[model samples]
Target: MTEDLTGKRALVTGAASGIGAATARWLAAHGVTALVLVDLDGPGLAALDMPCEVLPFPGDVTDEALWDRIEAEAGPLDYAVINAGIAGGAPIATMTLDEWRATLSVNLDGAFLALRCATRLVRDHGAMVLTASVSGLKAEPGTAAYGASKAGLMQLGRVAAKELAPRGVRVNCIAPGGVDTPIWDQTPFFQEMIAQAGGDRAAAMAALSGAATPLARFATADQIAAQIGFLLSDAAGTITGTSLVSDGGYLL
Candidate 1:
């Protein structure tokens, strides 16, 4: 068990699914009291049962006005985890402008907006963590847009830490490789991932189990969540403006 964030409040974008959802639950385990959960998943957030006083807001994180409204309503928080994202894989020549914008808007721009707003509403020395990805560190032929956006998020966290430091706040980023999240069930990459296992998801998943990565296998969302919970807690008081990669060794 970590330090209980009993009196602290929090806001997590993309709180209804995957790493976002895992983090919210992990914080609850450490005794969080208030959570303002934001995501397009209305019913999903509503369905969550936790001790925290959860306020679900359905909206896009890319809108500046959305953050303004969230800050006005959610009050001060102790931590903010920016974890929403999309996977767009296309060569630059074939990718449409709208596709590029969409990726940047949600993955990069959205994170920036949430961080900016959280900066205003968190306690002076509060903490913030952004979810970047292993893709940010490695670029592939078809994943240029997604990779660039995440790379941008990593940089954003550094700049945010610099801006928020004097104010007593800290900022950091998480770059996860692959996590066994439901989104994999919906993305085309899952098929490619499956093919890598010789036309079997289970087998391909096993193959992805990391002959290359030091940790081996895909990261479970819970695994990523634990790190997030740590950063938000007092345990990480001296840490900021850096990245915590949770790819189970995909980058190693």
Candidate 2:
């Protein structure tokens, strides 16, 4: 059943591209009227042309002051997608402190700031979804920093769920295994894979997904966005604190 978001308002971080942009579009299509989009990519955020009211805030999510302004300016929201994050990996032995901090600063700290604002401004009965990763649940080599950050995010969402329960606010985590998103190109690992696949991004992603997942395919941005939408909708009214892992059998 289609979730009717008519007259609802939402805040989506990392709205410039990837899962964030997909989620924004999803919400807009589902009848959300006002969407507050936050992303560092100003042009990308501005490029999104949706039917709803799009309020773009181009800034780093880690900036507390930026979040402060958003809290003061953006009105109360019915939903929040705390999804701004970066991807990187290295063996713990080789990962520098700077690399570790950089990942956590965005994936964890930035998420915390967004959550703080959402928890405060979101109306009672509103829902929020945090983007985590399968890496957080299943350990793998060279994913120390990224995995740790996502693990922290998962825990944070659970705690927020408990604290906000009294207010009728629902918080959950979406831990996707592999999805076709722009975040992959930002990482050297996937770039190398793309190059090796004769510059065909699709081929590379397919190869990776086939190797990693029992389903032999990765999800699309829209698929992940739909899952997030489900979690944020009234259909999930009784669900909170749990994680919906959309991993294509990767966990198995």
Candidate 3:
């Protein structure tokens, strides 16, 4: 049975696109009445046409003032998806201090801010899902900054879960391997790969996913969104402080 979220309200970071946007649409389709969508992409936020009430907040997640404004204005929420993040990668030796700090600022510190605000605004029995990445769990040469940040987020989710348990709130992480998301477009490596494939992004994605993933394909944003929805639902009431890795067997 599909869990109904009628009259529910939610906060979705990174909601302008990819998994965040998909989750927002999924929640609306499942009967959520309202959503407060946060993202750095103002145009992207404005472009979304969800069935429910959508309050789009455009700003950087790393900005504490932005989150503070949200807490003051968005009011109560039943669910929170702390999914705003960026893609950054470089070998430890070559990666600049600026690069390292940038990744941590958005993926880890930004999550902290969002979680803090959500804990204040979200009701007891509410749930939160952080969008961590498989890079955090399994190390790669160039992924130090990205991996460390996501690793921190995973730990943050666990700690938050423990701390919020007494209040009947649950926290979890979704560590996706490589679902096709616009976040990839931000990386120069992927852009070069696309160029190699004669600008066919799908071909580039297929080549990469086919090589690394046992499933031979990357997941779609909608697929990941469904998982997030399940995690936020009553069906996942007993699950907390854990990560649901949706990597298409890439870890293997």
Candidate 4:
């Protein structure tokens, strides 16, 4: 929609579907020429047919080595979207160590690894955005692991922004509330939450939408992706080290 990234090189992780996919498509539509998409979903990324130049690199964002390989594969990057994340729901007492670690590894550590590598290749006039959640700043008893990781991600963005600002590399984050995404299918906690809450699954998911939202609806993946696209562009040149909420005003 916005022709701000016409000559930029960008990378988007967790880009198979949902917000990541929306972001990649939007960037391409906006004229970003060099687009590097990273995901474990090789089939999905390979299947995408878009207008921009895309290099789909399949790997785990949590793996430190993946960043190195992406660099060797995609040349210099102008923007990086750290969009991979995990959700682990349960009382803290009953949560498994593996579950807890996986949440932090992908949401927090994965973001760090991406930004660390991106900062190296990002032109002096570059930017990076990480995907956080409304849970990052809200209170959710059952989502201890997920919330903690997301909260830490906001802090990571702040620190990275401070560390990278001097170099003209802007670092920021986007926190969305509940958006329609396949991530729900990947998590076991949704079913448990539905059962625990004693409500219809469709009703529950709809209830999370902007029923009381100031904006009157849940955010579409394209909506969040648009914000990400803006941040990566020169439009957000003065924006850095901040967690921009795209939750349709659930926090309000």
Candidate 5:
């Protein structure tokens, strides 16, 4: 059956780019009436020309005060996609305490804050999706901080799903593998890795995708967003407390 979002109100964090931005556009295409988009990139948010009523909120998702303002002004939300996150980290031996904390603050803590507020504000039967990573499920060298943060987010989603089930608010996590998103370009570790590969980021990405992913390619942000859109729709009403792995068989 086809999914429809006509006249529905939704909230999307990290909507300035990547999966969040794609999800917002997908929702608009599906006929959502109002979109409350939150992102730290003010200029990026302003550049988005969605067809719906766009309430662009430029702020940190980790800020409790920001969420308060969002809840007060955005009105009742029918869906939420908590996709704001940072990537890149060092090995445990080289990683500093501050680096670890910073990763957790944005990935785990930010997710917790968004989930807390979403549970309170989302109408009954509404759904939410958290952006996690394949690293959360499988270990990789030099990703101690990033992996731990996403793993925590995975557990958090499961627990929140159970707690919110009575209220009919479904909570699920989306763990994606390497996607050609701006986040990769902004990640220091990834940039350094690419530099090591003859300074060709595309070549490095292709090599990595060929070696690691069974599908031999990276998933697109819109592909991941499509899954997020599904979880938020009535078509996935029976799905909750589950982790949807869209990793092109990276975990396998």
Candidate 6:
């Protein structure tokens, strides 16, 4: 069932593409009045066409100044989807300090800033969803930084939920496995992985899915967006501090 969000406002981070963009569209489809979309992609943010009013903020999510601007400009938010992240892959022994910092800066610090701002600005009874990763729940060799950051994000959501409960704000986490998104194309590690499958991204994805994910396929961006939508809606009013795994049984 599509929830009616006619008068509500939402803020979505990493809004230029992938799951973030998909979630913005989903909120608009459900009748959200306005959206505050944040991302580092200027052209991508400017190009987005949505049904609701969009206030695009193009900047680094880790910047406290950006959050200050967002809070000032966005007014009262009814929902927040803290979904901005970057993937980093390397064995801990070989991973540079810079690489590890870069991953955690976005995946963890960014989430913390976004959630802190959201908890402050969201109206009472508001809700939020954080994009975590299956990597956090179950680790593999090359996921040192990414896995640690996501695991931290999951725990952050739980703590945020507890602290915000008194104010009627609910916070939840979504730990997605492999989703067919442009992120794969952008990450160097994934590019190499894709190359190993003879430059066929789909084939590589399928091979990985077959080997790891019980469902044998990648989750679509829209699929994850739908789950975010549900968590933000009234139907999930009682849910908080829960990490909803949408990984096609990858962890299983």
- Which candidate has the highest lDDT of all? 2
Which has the higher lDDT value, candidate number 1 or candidate number 2? 2
**Global lDDT of model 5:** 0.90
Which stretch of 10 consecutive residues in model 5 shows the poorest summed lDDT?
184-193
Off by over 4 Å in 4: 192-204, 210-216
Clash tally for model 5: 0
Listed in order, each prediction's TM-score against the native is 0.92, 0.99, 0.98, 0.91, 0.96, 0.97
True-structure lDDT of candidate 2: 0.96
Stretches > 4 Å off in candidate 5: 196-199
Q: For every model in order, what is the number of clashing pairs?
A: 4, 0, 0, 0, 0, 0
**In the order shown, what is each candidate's alpha-carbon RMSD?**
2.0, 0.7, 0.8, 2.5, 1.4, 1.1
Q: Write the per-residue lDDT of candidate 4 for residues 30-139, one digit (tens) a residue.
A: 88898899887889899888798889888888888888888777888888898987666878889899888888888888888887888788878688999999898998
Candidate 6 on 57-139: residue-level lDDT in tens?
Answer: 99999999999999888889999999999987888999999999999999999999998888889999999999999899997
Model 2, residue 153: what's the lDDT?
98
| lDDT by residue for model 2 (63-128), tens | 999999999999999999999999998999999999999999999999999999998899999999
Q: Which consecutive 10 residues in model 1 have the weakest lDDT in total?
A: 204-213
Candidate order, lDDT descending? 2, 3, 6, 5, 1, 4
lDDT of 1 by residue, 24-141 (tens): 9988877889988988788888888888788788888887887888988888888999898887787889999999999999998898888888888888989999999889998768
What TM-score does model 2 achieve against the real structure? Answer: 0.99
Give candidate 6's TM-score.
Answer: 0.97
Question: Per-residue lDDT for 136-225 in model 3, tens only?
Answer: 999888999999999999999999999999989999999999999999998989999999999999999999899979999889999999
Which candidate do you rate higher for TM-score, 2 or 5? 2
